[model samples]
Target: MQLTHFNASAKAGVSRASSRRTTVRVQAAAARPSWFPGNKLPEHLDGTLVGDFGFDPLGLGVDKDKLRWYQQAELVHARFAMLGAAGILVPDLFHQIGAGGPAAQIPWYDHAKFEYYAPINALFGVQVLLFAWAELRRLQDIRNPGSVNQDPIFSQYRCVCACV
Candidate 1:
C-alpha cells in the first residue's frame, strides 16, 4: 500500500466531499457512513489509484478527538517546516527552480543552507505534532475549556497564546 499525494487521470472521476482527509473516501461513497467526513484529496501511487485504503491495517485507528488535534498540528508544522526548509532550499517562497515542474513547484535558492537541518525538520515536525496533541488534551482537562473548544484546524493553527 503505497501512499501518494495526487490522483490519476483515470480515478480523477472521484468527487471531493470537502470533508475527507485522503482519497480513500471514495470507497465509502456507497455507504457514506456518518463517522467519515469525506476528503477531497486523492491518495495515489505515482498518480495511479490502486484502491482506497479506507482504514488501512497499519493500526492507524485512533481517537478522532486526538487525531483531530494531531492532524491540525501536523498541517501547521508541515507548513512551517516547509517554510523553514524551503528557506534553506529557496529563501524566496515565490522563487522557482529551473526543472520539470508546473512552475508553481519550482523553488528559488537557499543562501544559508544547513546540512543538519533536514533531520532537524523531521524531528521538529514530530515534536510539533506531539505538542499540539498534548495541548489539546490539556485544554480538554480544564473545567471550562473555554473558546478553544473550536474545530481541530482552529485549535491547531490558533496562536499558541490563543490556546488560552
Candidate 2:
C-alpha cells in the first residue's frame, strides 16, 4: 500500500522542492477611460490633436484623410448654416419692423412660391452653378492641397482688392 515511486525518487535525490521554478512577469494593462468604459480609445486619436478627447463614438474619422475632409465639410456646412439662419432672421426681423419693402414682407417659407418667376429661376440656376463649381474646387483642394489657389481663373482675382 506504500508509494514506492516517492521513496525511489527521494532515494535518487529527485525532490519536488529542489526543482527549478520559473517566474513569469506580466505587464499591467492600460486603464480604460471612465467615459468610454465599454470601448477602447481609438489609437489614431492621440491627445496631441486639438480638442481631441478621443470621443469618436462612430469611428467616422478613422482615416486621417477622411477626418480632414469631414472637418472641412463641417466648417463649410456650419458657415452655410449661419448664412441660412441670417437669411431667415434678417428678413423676418425687417418685416416685423415694417422695413425692407414688399420683399421682406414675404415670409421665407413663401419664397419657394416665387421660384417660378424667370428672374428667380435664373438666379437659382446661377447659384446652383456657382455652388457646384465651388464644391468641385473644394474637393480638388482636399485631394490636392493648394490646387484651388493656383487656378488661373481665381488667381487673377486674388489681387483685385490690392488697389484699395
Candidate 3:
C-alpha cells in the first residue's frame, strides 16, 4: 500500500509523485521563517483557530505591536524578571490574563516562567538576558563589598552563581 494525503486546493486526495512534491513544498515552506516586517499579527496565530471566545497563545488582541521572539523576551525581562527574585514566584493577575489568557483557560503563569524567571528558566530560552543580568550584578557586587548587591530588589535579582 501507499500513503495518501489531501491536496486541499485541488479539492481531492493526492498520492505518490504529486503528493510527494506537495509534501516537499510544504515541508520546505514550514522550515522557512515566515515572519515579515510590519506584520500586525503572527501568522501562526490569527485568532481563527481558537475562535473569539478562546485565547490565542501566540496572538494577543490588545497589543498591536507585533514583536519578534527576542523582543517578547526582552519585554518579559524588563517587566517581571526582577520581580521573580523579589519573591513573586507567580506572575501578576493582569499578566496571566493578558498574555496567555484566563488561568482556567490556560496556565499563563506557568508559561511566563521562562520570561519572568531568569537563570533558573534561562535554559528554556532566555539565556542571553540572564547572562547579561548576572554579569551586571557581578560587576556591581564587586564594588559594593557584597557577594551580590545589598539592595533588596537587586540582590534578589542576582543569579544563582556569580560566574554566569
Candidate 4:
C-alpha cells in the first residue's frame, strides 16, 4: 500500500516522493513577517491601511510620511502577526470545512458574547479573510464549505505585497 502526494508545480495527480515539502516552500517564499501575517488584512474599515495612514491619526490630517517610526512599527508589527497567524491556521481550518461544516457555522459572531459586532466583525473579518482565501484555494481540504472568494476590503494586501 502507498500514499502519494502531487508535486505542486505541474499537475495534481503526478509523481510520488518519499517526503515532499510544499507548504513550507510556499510559506517561505511568502516570507510573511512574524509580526504581521499575510492572512490578516492590515487595513481597517475606514479604509486606512497598515502603519501610517495617508491622513492623520491626530485629526491633523497629515500624511503617513509625517508619522514616527515606533507608531508606524506598532501597527506594522500587529498587521504582520495577524497575517502570519491566518496562514498558520489554514490546514486544519480547511479540513474542518471539508468534513461537514461551513465557515459561517463557526463562532464567527457570538451574539451572546458581544454587545457589539462592528469592531468584532472588523477584527474577525481579517481572520476570516485569511481563512476565506485558504478555503478558496483548497476547498477540498475545508471540513465544511463556504463560498470562498476575495473579500474586497482585505484585497488591499495586494498593494502591500507590491510595496514590500
Could you say which candidate leads in lDDT? 2
- Candidate 1 RMSD to the real structure: 21.1
Q: Write the per-residue lDDT of candidate 4 for residues 1-164, one digit (tens) a residue.
A: 34456645555676754456444322325433333334443332233345332333344333344333345446657887997777446634764666423433334334346355467768788999987675454433232333223334685433222211
Model 2 worst lDDT run, 10 consecutive residues: 1-10
After superposition, the stretches of candidate 1 with alpha carbons farther than 4 Å from their true spots are: 1-55, 89-164
How far in Å is the alpha carbon of 152 misplaced in model 1?
22
Q: Which residue runs of candidate 4 sit more than 4 Å off their true CA positions?
A: 1-67, 99-164
Candidate 3 Cα misplacement greater than 4 A, ranges:
1-82, 85-92, 95-105, 108-125, 144-164
lDDT of 1: 0.49
Q: How much lDDT does candidate 3 score? A: 0.47
Residue-wise C-alpha lDDT for candidate 1, range 1-164, written one tens digit per residue? 33336534445566653332343333434542222357333222122212333433343424546545555556777887987876555433343444433333433343224344467779789999998887666556443554554555655665455445
TM-scores for all candidates: the values are: 0.27, 0.60, 0.18, 0.20
Q: What is the C-alpha lDDT of each candidate?
A: 0.49, 0.73, 0.47, 0.46
**What is candidate 4's local distance difference test score?**
0.46
Give the 10-residue window scoring lowest on summed lDDT in candidate 3.
Answer: 19-28
TM for candidate 2 is 0.60
By TM-score rank, best first, the candidates go 2, 1, 4, 3
Q: Write the per-residue lDDT of candidate 3 for residues 64-89, one digit (tens) a residue.
A: 43333334445667766676644333
